[model samples]
Structure formats: structure tokens, C-alpha cells
Target: MDMEYLKQFSLDGKVALVTGAAYGIGFAIAKAYAKAGAKIAFNCRGEKHMEEALAAYKAEGIEAKGYYCDVTKEDEVQKMVADIEKELGTIDILVNNAGIIKRIPMLEMSAEDFRQVVDIDLNAPFIVSKAVIPGMLKKGHGKIINICSMMSELGRETVSAYAAAKGGLKMLTRNICSEYGNANIQCNGIGPGYIATPQTAPLRTPGHPFNEFILAKTPANRWGTTEDLEGPAIFLASDASNFVNGHILYVDGGILAYIGKQP
Candidate 1:
């Protein structure tokens, strides 16, 4: 392969906006973009989260621009985008990573709770993507990555709202690509598998049933890590994926492909 071919992966001179990137998967992707030479901008709903995220980013030697915004609100999203444009530049890359999940069963899930999940997981991406697309259009190029979940394809118990929202997000990802491909804007998704984050720490204890189940089901026999997602996020954000639009890249440790150990 040509050495120049590998250079296509570099994100130099790009400005990336990763929403709700206070921590977890969003933080990891932002770090990856920074490592690849992209300026990082992230938003959080509260000042507490924003401060924490800023400290974390600073500790890592990444000078990330942090904002306060509730991504689910269209007005807040629009304002945040405008601020980012004024402070940074026209957003060249957008990572719609803000989301919420209500793990109540379908029957027990309240309509209000369901709507909240949909608003954050599905609608917020639509809102934020809409806000940034105009700038992207004027700039003549952009990349939008929706943070989807495996629930986009598979259903599970006690997560009806999450599944519904993710399923909608998957379709929205495709729809954005369909609408904007001609404009040189690529919209795609990253459906992460069960990752070992602090939020999942309780479930990942050694000998925990859920941990064992995940290990047995995955062909890779291990839960995914934030670092595991960094490369894929970078690829989707970089020039290398200019032609790869409307795709959902699952970083699932092969769980989606494997049918589970033979009972």
C-alpha cells in the first residue's frame, strides 16, 4: 500500500464536535480524534459534568473545548453549534453521542420515560445533525457519526425504550446519508457492543453471571473497551471513509456474528 494511502486516516486541521462527551465512549472517541490531530469540542448538559470532563481531558493533555447544552433541546443545540462555529470553525465532524436508556420492561415502561429515551437517543441526533449540516454544507464537506447501540439490530429484555430509540437512530443514520450524500456529507453510525465502562462495572465483576454470559456469547470471549472503539470512530471521522456513508459499524467483539456457545 502507498504510504500516502495511510495518511488519509489523519484528521489534521479538522474540528470535531462530540456531544455528551463528558466520559465513556464519547470521551474515548474525542481522545482518538485529538490524537489524530483534530481539535476537539464536546458538550454536556450540566456544569458539573462539563467540569469533570474538562479535567479529564486536561489530565490527558488534550485541550478540548467544552460546552454546556442539553442536546435534546433544539434551541440549545442550535446555540451550541453556533458557539462552536464562532469559537472553532464550521464543524467538519459531528459525533452525536448523547443518549439515555430506561431499562424498564415494555409493559412497565411509562410513556413519559419512553419519550425521554427517544428524545435523547434518537431525536437529539436529528436536532444536532440538523443544526450542523448547514455549516457543513457551506464548508462543502462533513462527517456525522451517530452513536448507535446493538439494540439497533437486536432486542433485549428490560430495555424496550432503548431498543426503540436505537432502532429509530439506525434508520435516521441511513436517512441522513440518503439526504446529504450528494452534498459530500457522510452520515453513519457506530453500534457499540457491551463495553466495560464504569457504568457497567457492577455487571463486569469476575464470576458475575452477566459477565460470563457476555464472554460466552462473544466470539472474542471478552467485553469491549473504549479503546477498542477508538480506531473505528477515527476511521468514520476521517477522510478515509468519505465514500463509506449510511453504514453502521458494530464494534461488538463478534457478539452479533456469533450465535452463542452451543447449549
Candidate 2:
């Protein structure tokens, strides 16, 4: 047991920026990162959720702040990154967790729906990542965790576009690591399973067959919680994952390995 080799899990004095931090997995990750001793810049849709997250962090006795960053907007995203670096100091890590998905069937899904999902989920990561890279490069070290999805590797009938976007995100992450690994920057992704969140609550409703199928497929025999991802998030954000670059770490509940369909 080498003592000095074990300090990579600590994130003291680092700064992190997490998008979609108002609630759900993003919020949980932000709070956990703060608890691990990182100054946080949590972003949401509006000022209210940002303030609420900030206040909660204050209660936890950790340094946290709020910012308005619409990941879809290039200019706004750029300004937010700059503002975060200037106000909160350099952003040592970034979590691209802001995304949305529409559940309509492909034939019935509108063009706008597909575009919106791709824009926010996939395109925004590209925009925001670009905005933050220069800062990371200048500082000579940074970590990026793009919130991917199980859909990145698996496909569903009604969610073709969502799957496509996430798949693209997977390659994008690898490409980023390939191009920037030499610069001391690490880029990876977190593909969460069926987490119980406000956004995912609809997936687990009364008379919903999806829920039953999901549980049966997962070896854990239950849905995951947002809290389940906090440990992995902290590890990725900290120095623990310094050698872990261009990887898609699946936090799924073994559903990915299940070969049998639900009976």
C-alpha cells in the first residue's frame, strides 16, 4: 500500500464548472464535488436554481457559486467560462451535463424535437468544451467529464436521435482526448443508467412497461439514483483519473451486460 499514490482522489483547491446543476444528476455531482473541496461554478437554466444550489452549498460550508450558462449559446457559453475563470479562478474541471430528450416515436417526432435534443445534448458539449479548452491548455492541466448516456452504445426504437447524438458525443470525447492528451488535459464521459430524477421520473410511472423491463434487465434489479454517480464524478474530477483519458465509464447497473429480454 503506497501512501503517496493514494492522494489522487482528493480535489482540494480545484475549481469545477457543471452545467444543468439546478437539479438531477448534475446538481448531485456539483454538491459532491464541492464536498470533496473543489470550488464550484454550477450552471442552470435561470438565476433562481443557480441561487438555490449556491445557497445549499453555502450551508454545506464549501465554496460554491452560480452562473447562467445556456450551453447552446456560443457567446453566452464563452462569457460564462471567462467569467468563471476570472471570478472563481481557473476552471480545473468541467462537466457537460446539460441535455434533454423527447420520447415520441421517430415517425411522429418533429424535426424541431430532433434538432433540439441534438443541439442541447451533443452540440452544446462541443461549444462549451471549445470555450473551456484554451483556459485548460494555458493552465497545463484540466479534466472534462461529458455526461453521455447508455444510448451512446445502445439504441432504442423511439429515441433514434437521442442515441445518435450520444453516440456522436462518445467519439467527440475520444477525439478531444486524442488531440489534447499531450497538453495534460484529460477528457472522459459518464454514461449514467436510469437514475431517479425529476427528468427521469416519467420513465418509472404507474402502468409503465418500461420500468418493469428496465428492472428485469438490470442485474441490480432496481433503478439507479443520482447519488450513485457522485463517487465516480469526484474521482474523475480529482487527480485519481489522471491516466484515465478518452474513456467512456458506464455507471449503468449491469443492464448493458444483460442478454435476456424481460419475461
Q: What is each predicted model's overall lDDT from 0 to 1?
A: 0.94, 0.87
Query: CA shift at 122, candidate 2, in angstroms?
Result: 0.8
Reference-based TM-score of each model = 0.98, 0.92
Cand. 2 TM to true fold:
0.92
For model 2, residues 1-263, the per-residue Cα lDDT tens digits are 98677678777788899888777788789889877778888777777777777777777676777777788999999888989988988889999998888888999999999999999989999998999999899999999999999999999888978998999999999999999999999999999988887756897985688888888788898889988999989888888888999998899899788885635
lDDT score of residue 175 within candidate 1 = 98
Prediction 1 TM-score vs. true = 0.98
Candidate 1 lDDT, tens digit per residue, 1-263? 79798889999989999998889999999999999999999998778888899999999999999988888889988998999999988999999998888778889888999999999999999999999999999999999999999999999999989999999999999999999999999999999999999999999999999999999999988899999999999999988998999999999999889899986
Error of 1 at 233 (Å): 0.4
Clashes of 2: 0
Give the clash total for candidate 1. 0
Report the number of the highest-TM-score candidate. Answer: 1
Worst 10 residues of 1 by lDDT: 100-109
